[model samples]
Target: MLASLAQRFIALTLLATVGTAVSAQTLSSDQRVLKIERMAHGLDIPWAFDFLPDGSVLITEKDGDLLHLAAGRLTRVKGTSKVLDQGQGGLLDVLIPRNFDRTRRIYLSYSKRLGRGSATAVATGQLARRNTQLEGLRDIFVAAPPADSGRHFGSRLAEGPDGTLYVTLGDRGDRPSAQSLTSHQGSILRLNPDGSVPRDNPFTKQKGAQPEIWSYGHRNPQGLTFAADGQLWSVEHGARGGDEVNLIEKGANYGWPVIAYGRHYSGLKIGEGTTKPGLKQPAHYWDPSMAPSNLLVYSGSMWPDWRGDIFVGSLKFGYIARLSGQPLAEVEQIRGDETGRIRDLREAPDGSIWFLSETNGALYRLSR
Candidate 1:
C-alpha cells in the first residue's frame, strides 16, 4: 500500500510538471514593453517577495531557499528549513511585519511534510545575522493535520490592518471537502499572530466548524491582500478556465467547484453554473483563463495612471493584468506580452511595482 501511494505521488508530480510546461508554451502575446534583465540565475522557482526597510528584498524560492537581494546582488540566506516541495506546494508567501524595523520579525508560509503528504504552516522568526549569514530560525503557527493528498493546500498569508493573520487553504483536490465545515481545506482561516484562533471569527461559535475559519468554499486562492479601503481582495485559479478576482467579506462563501464560471478538466460542466442564492459572485473573472497567481492593488505613485488599479500576475499568459474603474468595471491585460511566467507582483515602499518570473527565475522593477 505504501509503494502504491508513492507511485501515485510520483505520477501526480509528473502531471503537474507537464501541466505547467503546457501552460507556459501557450503564452505568446507581444504587448509588453518591459524586458526582464536577469539579476541572478540558479535560484529555483522564486515564489514571493517582501522588501525590507533597508531597501533590500527577501525572496522565497518554492524549493525552500531564502535569498536576500540587495544592491543588485542576490545572496542565499543560510539556515532556512527544508520544505515539502511537491506539486503546488513549497515555500509560499513571505511578509515583513508592519513594525519590522523595530521588531525585526518576519512571517512565512510553507508546506511542511507530514507522514505521507504535507500541511501548510506559518512561522514568525527574527533575522539572525551570524558571520555573513541570515537565518529565519523558528516557527510560530502550524495548521492542523491534512489528509494524504498531493494537491491544493492554498497557502497564502495576509495581514489585516488590525493585525489579524488571514491564511487560505486549498481543497486538497477534493471538491467535496470544500463543503465540510470540519475540514481546514477550502477555507480562509483567521488567527492571532501567535497561532491562536480569533474569537470573532465567523465560525467561532458554530458547532462542528473550526474556529479558525473566517470564510469557506474557496478552491485555491493564491493571492490575497487588503486594499487601501480596508477591503480584502483575493485572486484564485479556477479549474480549467475560470480564474477569479474576488472581494472577500467576512463570513461569506465564495463558491468553488460548486458554482464556477469554468468547467472541469475533463470538459464537463462544474456545479450549478455561477448563481447560487447564498454564494457571492466574483468581482472579476477570466474565461479562457490567465491562471492568475499573485494580486496587487496599486496605490503607488510611480505609475500615476495605474493608481487604484488592481494588478494580477498571470502564469498561463506570462503577463500582468490591471483592473480598474469605479465599481471595478473594466479589466485590462497590461504587460501580458512580457517575458516568461509572471508569478507574483508587489508594491515597493517607494511606490514602484516589483514582479517575479517563475519560469526564468528573474525579478523585475516597474516604474513610470
Candidate 2:
C-alpha cells in the first residue's frame, strides 16, 4: 500500500464550508444477515468489475488476466497486455463503457512494463468473444514519465457523466515529486476516452504541470468514482496510517508528504502538521489505515437504503467500510471476519454486491 511496498478527518477551519454532503443508511456491520455466495475463484487479485449488457461480468486480475464470467462460465480472454506485476503493480482496473453494446468497447488500466519498472497505462479496444478468448485490443492512454518503482501504482479508472475518463496515479514512491508540477506522480488525471488531455483541464495552461492533472498532492489513490451528483471521490493509502477518503476538485492540492494525519512507519511525525494553507483536507480518514483498494458510490436499487453511500474495500482490515455524512464521514464497517482482504467491490446489475478477496483468490456476492 505504501511506496515502500507496504501499506484524516477534516480540520474544520481548514475545510471549505462548501461541498455536497454524503448520505448513507444507518446499517451497522453486524446488522446485515445477507448471504455471501462465492461467485468465482482461481483469481489472483481481481481488481475491477463491470457488468455487460448480456449479464456477463468483465473482471481484471492484477496478474494481467482479463476474465469474462457469464452464467457460471469463466473465460480467460486473450490479448491482455503484459504487466510488470511487481510488489503492488499489475493489470488493475477494467471498465465497460456505457456505449458498449454498440461500440463493443471496454477500458483497461494496468502497470505498463518499462524496463524493470512500470507506469500506469490505459487502453480500450473492441471486445469480441471467440470461443474461449478475446480479441481486438488497442491502447488509448499511457502515463507519462514512467518510473521504475514497484510500489504505489494508483491505477483506477472512472467515467464521468460526459464520458471523460478519470485516472488516479500514485506518487510512484517519489515523495518530493508529488509537490512538483512537472511530474505525473501523485495526481488525479482527467483524459478523453481516446487518451488526449482535455482542453479545460486544471493545469492545461500551466507551463510545467502535466496537462492531464486535475488534482494534486495525492499519496497513492487506489480508487476513483463519480457520485450521483457528479462529484468525484477517491480513497488512497497512507504509510503507517492516514488512509483517506477525499472529495476531489479541480486544481485542489491534497497535502500528502507535506502534511498528513498519519505518521511515518518509523513512528515519527509527518509534514509540518495536518492542516495548511491552500491544501485540501480529506472528507474522512482512518488513523490505523484500512489499506483501501477501491471505492464505489452506490446508486443501485437493490439496497435502497444505500443510495448515496460509499463502499470501500479494506485490504488491510479485511472488510467493507461504508462511509456517509453531510460532509462525508465513516459510518460503519461490514463483515470484517468473513470477508478476507477485500481488494475491490461492485454492485451488480441485479443489485447484488460483488467483491473480490485477494487472500482467497475468489469473488463473493452479497444479497438479501
On TM-score, the leading prediction is 2
Residue-level lDDT tens digits of model 2 in 33-118: 66666666656577888788888777888778787776555666778888878788888898887888888888888888876667
Clashing pairs in 1: 154-170
lDDT (tens digit, per residue) of candidate 1 on 21-91: 33221222234343233333444688888888888878888978777766555555666666898888888
Model 2: how far residue 266 lies from native, Å: 1.3
Q: List TM-score per model, in order.
A: 0.86, 0.89
lDDT of 1 at 304: 65
- For candidate 2, which ten residues in a row score worst on lDDT? 7-16
lDDT of 2 at 6: 17
- Each model's Cα RMSD: 7.7, 10.7
